[model samples]
Target: MIDLRIRTARPDEATRVLVFWKEAAEGTSVTDDVDGVTRLISRDPEALILAESDGLLVGSVIAGYDGWRCSLYRLAVLPSHRRRGVSRALLEAAERRFAAVGGRRGDAMVLEANEQAHGAWAAAGYRKENHWRRWVKPFAGPSRPV
Candidate 1:
């Protein structure tokens, strides 16, 4: 395995993260922009976890704990770094973050078409909740203020 360092992302690294996602992530997200990522970091600085090797970003995972649910998103590792324990390290870090915050359970948002991700998630001991299906409706404009 490569020499890995895991840490929470800084707000200033949003752009670099986005670029890394494009290369490493399997699918696109509606909130994959600078503003969205910046907002996420601004709101929960510890939610975004990053993995680096020799100062080069190799993986990331969003371990978002919203008081009730622990949601994992954007679990991605560079193709060059796959099977090198990058994803495993990222998930372990994410799970640690969730447990530290009193999260009861953790769930990941994965694409149906990404079969490769299935094995990775399973290897990390995350089973699919076959009974639960994700439902989403994107807003046409800016989100309403809370």
Candidate 2:
């Protein structure tokens, strides 16, 4: 419940964020490492949003816009900071940023196995698209086989 500061993360801080995610986030993405995250920041500086309380990292969300669709990823809050409006604040900031950039819809990438996140996303007015399925092909590095 402390005052939280939501801001964009610098590319140099990607390693710290990777460490934080390993601890706070439920699951990991193929690009969860320092180099990958650093690349993301380098490409789109505003996409990696961070939340800090008293200068300590507490929450994070990636709001990415590809000139059209808005996609949210890595919406994670520290275990101790859950239910403290940290995620909401991050999401609100991301939503505002998306709206400002002419994004009409926001899609979140969530793992189906992370049932705990289901309630949080639902409470924030997001629903799963049962009619659609994600198909991905990895050109480099680690990836889930399709």
Candidate 3:
């Protein structure tokens, strides 16, 4: 029996989810803050998935579909919860959401520097697109010095 309870994250849980992502997720994104998260929740309520065990958040994944594209992000699992199907559960929920919305494919943003995530993603049946490189342009906002 899978003990983890996977569900859509509630609006009020955005802060808590961000805190968890900081600890377990590979890296942060431009939308990792409270306002950005709130906007995400408001725009697509079911896009953010959370996995909990015994009242504690163990894993999370964002499955965002903007009519034309489906993107996954922030897939994370607590260190103690890794390898216990937490991430799998989150991904499953995300996939289901995408499928229901007629999404033909899903793309995930995994940092190339995070080697540990490579194996996990591969294990989940995701292949790396070697020819593709990400391009970004930061808008004027609270940008972090990296």
Which candidate's lDDT is highest? 1
lDDT of 2 by residue, 1-146 (tens): 67999999998898899999998997767787788899999999999999999999999999999998999999999999999999899999999999999999999988899898898899999999999888888766766742
Q: lDDT per residue, candidate 3, 21-116, as tens digits? A: 988987777777888888899999998999999999999989999999999988899988888888878888998899999999889989889887
lDDT for each candidate structure? 0.92, 0.91, 0.87
lDDT of 1 by residue, 83-137 (tens): 9999999999998998898999999998989999999999999999889987766
Best by TM-score: 2
Better of 1 and 3 by TM-score: 1
By the lDDT metric, which is better: model 1 or model 3? 1
Error of 1 at 68 (Å): 0.1
Predicted candidate 3, C-alpha RMSD? 1.7
Per-residue lDDT, model 3, residue 43, is: 92
Score candidate 3 by lDDT. Answer: 0.87
Model 2 lDDT-worst window of ten: 137-146
Report the C-alpha displacement of residue 55, candidate 3, in angstroms: 0.6
How should the candidates be ordered by TM-score, best one leading? 2, 1, 3
